[model samples]
Target: SVEELRKLLSDKDAYENYLHSIEEVKQLDTLRNDLRKRNVTLARHNLGKESEMAELRNQCMIIRTTELATAQEKFLDAQRREKEILARSSPASILNKLQEAANAADDESESLHRKLLSGELKVPEFLQKYRQQRVLYHRRTLLRLAA
Candidate 1:
């Protein structure tokens, strides 16, 4: 009778161990499902970040292109203005015209002086003409200084 009781106790212990193993398996399956859900959420978040980055990059490229085009247009406008200025008044032609003006002023002063010396112009007339000539000369000098 004691041997029979030992056999029954041993069988009961084996059954309990099998039931514990099954519970452990169920816990492992639950943990696996939770991990799978977290992985899907992370994947979606990564995709959203990547899309935002792409849009930002496109906007940056568009801004850069517009700025470059504006700069190019401004550069072309400046070049056109420079050409117009050069065509209207080249340095050589401006210098030649200035030289001719100086020579004319000198000749006029010498002629006035000769006329006064020869009594061709009265003292009063000569003084007035001389003052006018001096004013003209001074104006020219001021213009040259300003330039």
Candidate 2:
């Protein structure tokens, strides 16, 4: 009877251990499932970020291309205007024209001064003509300086 009782106790202990192992296995399976869900969420988040970054890069490239085209068009327009100006008047010819106008103004001023001194022109008329000649001469001089 003692041997039989010992054997019965041993069977009870083995059954308890088997139940504990089953519980541990269930806990491990729950943890594995949680880790799998987290991995899926992280993968989705990474994909969204990658797509957003790609769209932003494309937008930046488009903006840069538009700006480059506008700048190139402006450069070409400036070049065309420069060519037209050069064709119409060379710098040397422009300077010569200004010089001739200045000389003519000086000659007219001298004639007006002579007429005033000789009493051939009235004082008011001489003053008016002298003022006009002086203004013309000054304008031509300023133009030459700017050129």
Candidate 3:
């Protein structure tokens, strides 16, 4: 009877772990969807602002402000992903690795932005207004380099 009880408890633990993994995947999916929606909204806003540039002499300044806001939003999205990965990580050490990866991505994106702003790199008009795209590009480049 004791052996049977131990087996039952082990099975329960395994079942619970499986459920947790499923939940984590769902959470990650939700975060991805939300991030995509935010990106689309940012693009639409920037396009609309650019379309009115002839009438609004302040379009360039507005684009810069919007670009900053979009970058901040992308940063927040990465933060959320970092948190989710941390939560999903097992043995706990994986959380640190995931967080480090996210932070490194953020750092690379910031460096690119600084270079663009300092005129070290020439950024086209569309890129100047779309900071999230720049962040994504930088983040992917960093990840690839790390890999």
Name the best candidate (by lDDT).
Answer: 2
Return the lDDT, model 1, position 63.
Answer: 99
lDDT of 1: 0.80
TM-scores of the models, in the given order?
A: 0.36, 0.40, 0.26
Per-residue alpha-carbon lDDT of candidate 1 for residues 1-147, written as tens digits (9 for 90 to 100): 777566657898865555556977768878998999999999999997998999999999999999999999999999999998886598666655665676677678778999999989998988888777767766665665556
What lDDT score belongs to each candidate, Candidate 1 first? 0.80, 0.90, 0.72
Off by over 4 Å in 2: 1-88
**lDDT string, candidate 3, 48-126, tens digits:** 8885876676777789899999999999999999988877765455545655666665676677678788887777743
Stretches of candidate 1 above 4 Å error? 1-88
Q: lDDT ranking from best to worst?
A: 2, 1, 3
TM-score computed on alpha carbons, candidate 3? 0.26
User: How would you encode candidate 2's per-residue C-alpha lDDT over 35-137 as one tens digit per residue?
Assistant: 9999999999999899899999999999999999999999999999998889659988789889899989989999999999999999999999999998999
C-alpha lDDT (0 to 100) for residue 24 of candidate 3? 78
**Alpha-carbon deviation at 71 in model 1, angstroms:** 33
Candidate number with the higher lDDT (1 or 3): 1
Model 1: C-alpha RMSD to truth?
Answer: 10.1
Extract clashing residue pairs from model 2: none
Backbone N/Cα/C clashes per model: 0, 0, 0
